[model samples]
Target: MSALSSSVQAVTALWNRMPFVGRVASQLTVVNIFDCATRLAAQAFLSAIPVLFVIGAFAPQAVRDQLVESLRTVMGLGGATLDQVQGVLTADSGNVKDASGAVGVLVTLASATACSRALQRVCERSWHMRSAGLKVVMWRWVAWLVVLLVALIAQGALHDAFGAGALLGIPVSLVASVMLWWWTQHLLLGGRVRWLPLLPGALITGIAVVALTWGSRLYVPRTLERSVDQFGPLGAVFTLLSWLIVFFACITVGIALGYVVAHEQPFDRWLRTSAATGRTDPADDADLAEESAQRP
Candidate 1:
């Protein structure tokens, strides 16, 4: 492990000396962001299916339309893709639907809960950090659900306050989005990273998320068109999966870039370097303990 770290440090030190693009390229190779993203996206999408079904049962037309439009903006779902999603979600059939929906909800919730745990593990792998204990499990859920609540409330507040004023609305929305993203990162990875070091990545992620949300209008429709032709209703599923993959990839890159920029030392100071908080890297802590054992 020490040898591998030494090699990575040596390569990273050299790679760091290169231009920004070169460093990013090297780090991207090191992180396996795409593989991690694919797993996250697939897991999330599969687990969301039954939740969508339950949501379909109670959500009003106006609510569903708003959601559909948001999906179009974020994942390019419209036309047949949009119709298919609603059909699957709102397959109403009285008691049969209720019974089946209840079962589906339980199964999907369990899957989503497991996948959320996997997501934490993936973050640890990507950032090369410590495993969390069962003690943190409840706190993690609290933090995550709190962020989701904040996001929803913020969206509603913004719309209610600025529904008529486009000139005043855009900046407010942007600010809200940025704040939401930052808070989300803080909650998601707070124990592993400090606030100061986490900001850059969170900001990058926020901007990327906004860009994706806006740009979905341009690309999502065409993608959805192709997806439907290729796989019928499943096309919406796959298209949504594709969007999720890119979204997670953006998140991984943001975290990595923040770490690269925040925690790395200059080449000249590498040997004597300490991290921002003057703490040993968690990755090296175990090895240091083991080495201490051998010395005595």
Candidate 2:
């Protein structure tokens, strides 16, 4: 009875020291799902301006007309019914002029900036660390660029080789998705080391992300469809809100999992140590202090 009592006390103490552990663990299970949804939303928002710029800057009239026609077909709109859209696309001056276009470009740049800042905030919140500044941000961008280039090239090659009918595409897509998650985590966490150190934890987290994303894709959309069918367009708003909740939940989980995978000590142990010491590790403390000092 005494031994059992002692074990119970020990377990209680551990939980007391790391109250967030169970919550974080449960949350981590859904991390990728939330991350995918939030990231998709953020990307959609940020990419809109740039996409417009690209259309205006590079696409020819024929190409633009073809794109409009494609969209019309997809949306089941009447033929050439997007006349206003074409006019907007072809508008030469006034509000639609290039100078006015700069506003969207600036907004896009701001969104990108916000994403980097938000990523840094996530790192700080999760690991008690901050990235160095423009240098770190630039490096992170370069890393992502490399990852994106590789994914695009590989995806094209694989799709061409396998044709549209092959099952190999799924696995290839999964692998690419994992690589992307890994790269993003690596960048956000200031893990600019050799690939060896970065790959293992990144791979683990990436796989988790891929599984969650695939599952969400399979399930959430259908669920949302049902809700919309039952509740009308208002249901779409609820669906979006649900997506946001899931997205943040996934991010918290992924951050915790990444920290666990990368560190030597378990979170419970670290939490206990921090509580007992009444302070974080000196390195973490210094990093936080530095970040505070650097903030504008």
Candidate 3:
């Protein structure tokens, strides 16, 4: 009976610690914007190549021709004939699509390369120190890639089945987004901490990510449309900037949230410390530095 009581108390203590962890994560997220942005940009750029290639290869020839024509019109090259545009599109599309099969290989290599870089960036931004080695970093990236692919495929299937506007589809997407965020949290913090112990933080970060994603989908496109309507061509640039900022911000926040939840540290304390000292906690710093020091 005494042992059972102790076990129940231990569980209660852990449960009580979660909210504090979540708050810290949110605070840290706001503080580490630049670090998160650089890593995210690298990941985005690497991922985009494969995505574009897949789109170019799989999309119908007619669609590609239309896209090129639209670009020509946008560029005010009215004299640029459809045949010229079509020829260029055909050549480019072939090159892009022909590489589709290689995308997985490329993505794997790119993620491995980026993981070390990302770890370094995160450590430097959050903490003052760096770590080295690619083994754990590569594994983390691979894990994230697997989870991302699963989420994307599931989301795509849900969209196909119910359409995005359906009531059921909305909840399904929300759940999936949360899962993606949870998996991402797991990937990022898994090295220093056990996955099971970090469940609360992962869950909290996942919920926040889902909320942000849904909110952004509603607001961002409309905001872009309005800006374009008001500012003409220049609005397009602004729209792109807006999207990048929002995306980077959300990613940073999500990461911070996950970290806080897993560590149970106060967000403001870390944020202030990171800024004043220009360094994060030693534990967080160690993994990245270790990964970077590893030989290729």
Candidate 4:
């Protein structure tokens, strides 16, 4: 018992010595980062996937084709894997469009907002901010969906422009991801946090996005194909869900790490100096101090 107590004290002492990293670690524990990522993944899979299929049903043939092309580009889908997805989207599309009227479409879109709301909670928690009311953020939710869908489609074109290879495409994807995530944080937070402080998180998220996108190309296509062959559409569903979990886990970690980095020594000091120069809001310092005080 004495030995165990000594070890615990040593660990505590070590943690105390690294205040910045300790605060970050404490915040992550308080937020249950992995749990949050899993929830986001499940929410997105359940809500966003159905919404995408429904939207595809409503879309014209050309639009549906473009959607498949974008997915293929992003996931490196080919052969049987690509066919399974295209069939899912296009097989009952006409029937779906005919059966679902405007009301159905509206309902599908509203359900998709669950993903937006989940992501907004992540940002709010990372910043230790209160949730914005529905009225304040409802429009932002819909707008975010529109923006995300547009970006998804545009990603194919972005890759094609960069020689359709990972060499150049990686950098393009990283830059695009940074800009998109930066804007996403501001939009989802209802502009409560300024743009500059959000930079570290966005850059971290961008790197993660690029790395995952590149890496997924090597793994997802083969795994997807095998799953489809062995378990049909259901297998594909499971595989995609598993992938989404990993994807969101990395994203959550990146965002949390960004918060930590931005609030730690050199970066925190730099942000404060910038605030003094009128480049950033001095109010952010209070936010940092308050967050630290609340840390376990």
Maximum-TM-score candidate: 4
Q: Which residue window of length 10 is worst by lDDT in model 4?
A: 273-282
Give the winner by lDDT: 1 or 3: 1
Clashing pairs in 2: 31-250, 34-246, 34-247
Task: Report the lDDT tens digits of candidate 4 across residue range 68-110.
Answer: 8777777667777677667767868778777777788888888
Candidate 2, residue 112: CA error in Å? Answer: 3.6
Superposition error at 93 for model 4 (Å): 5.7
Q: Model 1: which ten-residue window has the lowest total lDDT? A: 267-276
Per-model TM-score on C-alpha atoms: 0.71, 0.55, 0.54, 0.84
Write down the worst ten-residue block by lDDT for model 2. Answer: 72-81
Q: Cα RMSD for candidate 3?
A: 12.7
Give the residue spans of candidate 1 off by over 4 A.
1-16, 19-26, 58-65, 88-97, 100-106, 142-170, 190-192, 264-296
TM-score, cand. 1 vs. native? 0.71
Query: On TM-score, who's better, 2 or 4?
Result: 4
lDDT of 2 by residue, 75-125 (tens): 222322245446655655344446546676555555545545555455444
lDDT of 1 by residue, 1-296 (tens): 99999999999898777767685665565556786678778767776666566556655655555555455444656787677776865566365356756677556556556555545554444444555566765467445643543454345334334465644545665677667655655555546554565566666766776666657768888887888898887886777788889988877777667555554555213422133223446667455434422321
lDDT of 3 by residue, 1-296 (tens): 99999999998798677767555644564345665664555565455445434545656775564454333322222222334445444666556555546766566456544643563345333332343346656576656655554443344344333454545655665566666654554455434433443344446545665565556546655665676688965665565455555555565555555444444446435434233332355556545445433423
